[model samples]
Every structure is written in structure tokens, then in C-alpha cells.
Target: MSGSGNVHLRQMARQDVAAGMELVQAAGWNQTEADWNRFLDANSEGCFVAEAESTVCGTAATIIYGHQLAWIGMVLVHPDMRGRGIGTRLLRSAVEYLESRGPLVIKLDATPQGRPVYQRLGFEPEYEIERWKLTATPSLHSAPGAIPLDDDKPDIEDVIALDAEAFGASRSALLHSVHRDAPEFTAAISAEGRLLGYTFGRHGLHADHLGPWVAEDQEIARRLLETFLDRSTGRCLIVDCVKAHPFAATLLGSAGFEFSRPLTRMVRRAVQSGRRSGLVCAILGPEFG
Candidate 1:
């Protein structure tokens, strides 16, 4: 761990979050310690920080969620460390680790500058989404069918089942970590207790922006969003959508959401699968990008 020493990329320690935050901010992303903790808790030991002679220099995190999908995010290198291969190596190490867990559908949200690096690594573009902003506070928009925040406790079992169904993999442990700090989590339901759609969010929790807003019915989905925003405070909300959640994205746009930054959802099918369409809707966490 000396200046002249080789690049040493390894798991991040809590102390690294402060140094890592500087690198993330300098890189122009609002990565905070809360975000780091969430990432660390999600896939324990999967958070990484690179250092040189007692100074933390680079950071990245890999989230292996619901089992099959693994995502890489918060990839940052100190301005001074850019010319070295630290960023690239840190990324590779993360991918290798996920690959070891089992088959994976690896994906990452790429900044314009990093897109080419990922493309070179065999990931193909799936879709691009604009991050929307809410210009003004709208009064709580709620409809009768929208469900209230349930379980003063997070529903581990239902969440596990629904999340697994959505992602097509089982990852309760990782999901358990996600449950720890969820402030607002809602499930859209009909007059009966059928699971129409659901949205879970954690504040001061990593991926602080909530989403994956889904409802079997588009209108119900929109109403759920209204309740979601009405209950929270932030200039806006952000979400990633695939073709399946057509109305979900449309509703956000209509509600004054604006693109703070948009990202390309890319994936490398380095693992085998029956088909991808089924799990596309459940790719919940932004960390999995």
C-alpha cells in the first residue's frame, strides 16, 4: 500500500466511506456515506475501495440481488488516480466475484464517459432512461385503491416471494439487508388482497430515490406513485423502466419528473437463463442498474 506499490483493490472498510465520498463527489455523483452503507449491507464484503500508501483512492460496489442479477455501481477513481488501471481492475474484480456466486446477468448503469469501457467488456445496451425531477410539491395525490404503507415492519416473506418472482432468483439475505432501513414501502392492491403492484423505498438508505413502482393496473400504479411522493420529501423521484412498466414511466413524466441524469441499462448475459423478459420488471434496485 505504498505510492510506488502496485494497485491493491480490495473490500472497503467503514473508514473508506469518507475518502470514497470525496472521490464520488469530485466525480460529480452524489454518493454519500449512507449510500455506501446500504451498498455494503446489501452484499456484505462486495463494496470495494482502492488505496495507495494509506490514502483511499478509488471506490466501486457490486450488488448481487435476487440471486441471478449482479450490478456494478458507484465506480469512481480519484482525479489523481485516473491514469492508472485502478478503475478497470476494480470493476473486473467485482465481476469475477459475482460470477463465482453462480450464473449471473451482469449489468451496470454507465455514465457517458464510462459507457465505452463497459461496451468493450461485452455488455450490450438494453435501454436508456432519463432521471426525472418534480418541479413543485403537488398535494398528496391518492386514489381509493392505493394501499397504505404496511407492516411497520418490512414484509420479508412477501417481499422475498415478490422480489424473487420479479427478479427470477432467490436472495433473501441480500433482501434482508435492504429491509433494515426502508422508510416507505407500498404495495398496490385491489379491493381484495391480491398483489397488484408494489414499490419499496429507503431514505438515508442507499438508492435513496425510491422506485420499481409497479401495479397490475396502470392507473393503480399512478395512484400509488402519488401516495409515494406525497409521503416523501425530495424535489423529485427517480425510476428505471423496461417495456413492461410503460405506464409507470408515463405517470412520473406527467407528475413533473425531470431528468437529472439519464443512464443506459446494459447487461452481459454471462450466465445462462431460460429467458430474460420475465425478470425484467423485478430488477428493482438502482444499484443493480
Candidate 2:
């Protein structure tokens, strides 16, 4: 019911799914209609989409976590609408709605272009990071001392609990979502049965993306990552590592992992209490913000 020069911002409706997803791909975020629909369907509280002249112009979603935190999502702008303030308006609406509801502010990872806009809106840079992915052989065989987390029903909940403690965020749903029926992903533990580390990922159409690779230490982290590559064999194995972490540069560099993409985990004031580098893989996902 809103329009501005053919541009309108409002909550996304059930009918908006297909067109909204088409717009998502056109915005160059590398997501699909199915992905967009699933995201919106899961988000009952809401999603924000902007339409221009009855066509999809932009879309973003907010997934509220326990009424105390909300994660921003899929902020896309039409290719033709670049620099027209469509995205800014969509993002602003999301933040404003969240702030008014009082959810300790919000957080999101931004692409280079998205970074500047968020910065202008008071979002702060979180330790200069990049989402690095590589698909070689699975690291399972090559990484020394690498043992699968699920070998004997490895306590997924325990690993998730450790992750929540390290990242200082409520991620049970996230852990459940990523680990459910996804075998390409993996978790690593020490010989002494200590909760060492893990990598969450899935096989996508183009490539397999492993994110949120967290660990107890550099050695364990290296083993977990190396295991992924070794297990991949002829297949492509992917991982997203944070530059801010202590051994990310060294380990990835040693493994010949190149920086193919750059993204930022942008944050605004009334900040949520969590350390992205402490026990993070890739800030969960850039698209999830």
C-alpha cells in the first residue's frame, strides 16, 4: 500500500516470495529463490522488501532470536537501482523497526559496497575480515589427528554449547539447522575427548561453503580444516575463515587458501555482547548478517 516514484517499502507478503527471490539473484548476493523463500517462510515476525512500479526492487529480512536479539538478512537491491537509496531505505526500515522494539540493536556482515552505507548509518567495522572459501579434497585424511565429531554419536549439543559459550550468542537453532542431515560438514575433537572445533557447511549448486569454523586452538583448528580438504578428494571443499582470528592468516596461507572474496561483519551501537573472532567460523553467514 506504499509507493514512492514506483518505489515502496513494506513487510514482505507470501505472494512476494517468487519475485523477491528473483530480485535477490539480480542483486548479486549469490542466493536462490528457494533460499529466499525458505528464509522468509521461517521468519514469521517479518521480512522487508521494496518494490518499484510493481516490480521487485529490493529485499531484506530480520530473524528475531528469543526477543533479545534479531539478525538482519538478505539485503538486496535491484541492479538498476544502484545508488538510488533503495537499499538504504530498506535497511533503515529494518533497523528502525528493531530499535523501536528494543532488541539490543542488531548485527550483519556487509560486502564492500554494503559496508560504507552501514558505516554512514553508525554501523562499526568488526576487526577487518574476509570470507575465504576453498574447494580442494576433503581435509579428513590429510589433517593429522583429525577425528570426526559424529563418530559414535559425538555430542552435537555439547559442541553447540561450547560454541554458544565462545561466541556469546544464542545459536542452538543455528547449530541445529546447519548440522541437520548435512554430511559434507564436520566437527573435530582432541584425543582426550575435549571439544576442540568444527566446521558447518553444505553442498550448494555451484560450490560447497563451510562456515563458522571454530576451534579450541590453532592446532585443532588446522586439523579440522585440513580434514575437510583431505576428505573432499576430487570434490571441492569450502571454508570461510575470519582474518581477525589468531591463526587464520598463517594456517590458510600455509594451506594455500586464497582470498577470493571480501566481506565485513558490521555492527551498530547498543551492541550485542559476543566476540566474532573468539569462537567464530565466518560470523555464521554474511547473507544472514
TM-score of each: 0.80, 0.84
lDDT of each: 0.63, 0.67
Pairs in steric clash, model 1: 1-53, 131-259, 132-258, 133-257, 133-258
Model 2 over residues 1-289: C-alpha lDDT tens digits? 2344778888887788777766755654445454555566566446888877777778878765655666677888877777888888988988887787774557787878888888888889765567565544333446566555456355777777776666656667756766663555756574566766776665543555666678768877777677666555345444456766778767776776667777777777766666444766454567653
- For model 1, the superposed segments whose C-alpha errors exceed 4 Å read 1-6, 42-45, 139-156, 204-208, 234-236, 270-285
Q: Please write out the lDDT profile of model 1 over residues 156-248, one tens digit for every residue.
A: 576566655665466566555545655454444444554555666555322345555545666666766766776666544455555444565
Model 2, residue 261: C-alpha shift (Å): 2.6
